[model samples]
Target: MPVAVVLPGALNPLAGCVPPFDRCGARARHATGPWASSQGTQILENGDAVDLTWVESAGAPVIVKEESLRNLWGGYVNSDYENACEVDGYAGLVTFGEPTATVTGLVINEIPAPTAFMEEYRSIVQWISSSSDARFVEMVREGIASVSMWDEGPIVRVNGPLAIFDAALPGTEAGADELLLVEIESDTPAPARESIGWIP
Candidate 1:
């Protein structure tokens, strides 16, 4: 029996919660197709269906729906100061603050419409950008380069528009993942598409 860990959303945690044994049983049922003798056998008790290995063997395509895109950000930020010098020396002195790191990136892999998820994502991004405790703003400002989605195929290709950040906000990076995941389930299923940029 193979064990798997499943993380469900906050709203429907139970639906996502599957005991290890139950997971094994479900996998066994899906596999072997109702024509076998024992529940744990690789072949499965039900010969009618295929076993977990069989499903993997058939190579059934695991489509990443619009709701599965993961967003992420990575970078650092620094402060610079300049002061004029008196005497015969360089024109001015430059000073820099300690560098802070952060992570920022959107996982658009399975997201159907990423634009819609921007509001929540932005809130978190903003929080990280301005967080004084973590000092992660620097990283949030520079870490994230771009946000894109990819479809599984012979050659993984970007699926939709690219989301790029214009300015850094406070407290964004700390909870970016949770924010994006929440946004994905806001609406019903739809065809996946790329997002240009989030406004809010």
Candidate 2:
């Protein structure tokens, strides 16, 4: 199960929690079509239904209503997507203490919006300025905190609106530095449930 999140030692708050994706891939990676009908609940082999959230997946961030699990923030819907950071493989997390090397870009308050920081690098402000979905706009409130692309991709990199990496760009919070960006790494996109990880 290539479980991506890798927080060190006791630093990980969501230690015992079940990561959304299994070795096969993400449970509810996309959010559309039949997936939208499922409404964030997956049925077990024993005929039980479990509530799903925007949890983790092996590869490829999804935003389609049918394909997306629930929330825009992939991987366990915590307080804010920023909370899990490294635990979810996102860089530029909103840390509580002083800034770490992974952090960069403008401090949260200084920027007009989270998307502002990426303007220089990706030109996201233009797209965000035209969005209508409030949640999509709200999605960028967290991090990639590295918000620093690894010569790889955008910060949110989600499938929904604010997903700069989504090819639909747009686009946090916390302490003074907590608002600062952090480091992010990219993983190869996992094929759909039946392709690479899970057996159809």
Number of backbone collisions per candidate: 62, 31
Q: Which sections of candidate 2 miss by over 4 Å?
A: 1-31, 54-167, 172-200
Q: State every prediction's TM-score relative to the real structure.
A: 0.15, 0.20
Residue 112, model 2: Cα distance from true site in angstroms: 30
- Candidate 1: TM-score? 0.15
C-alpha RMSD by candidate, in order: 23.4, 19.5
- Top-TM-score candidate index: 2
Compared with the true structure, what per-residue lDDT tens digits does model 1 show for residues 1-200? 11011111112212221121232322111222221121222321333222111111011111111122222221112111001011111011122223453212222111111111123123222221122212222233223333243122121122333222211111133233212122232332332332222211
Candidate 2 weakest ten by summed lDDT: 191-200
Score residue 60 of candidate 2 by CA lDDT: 24
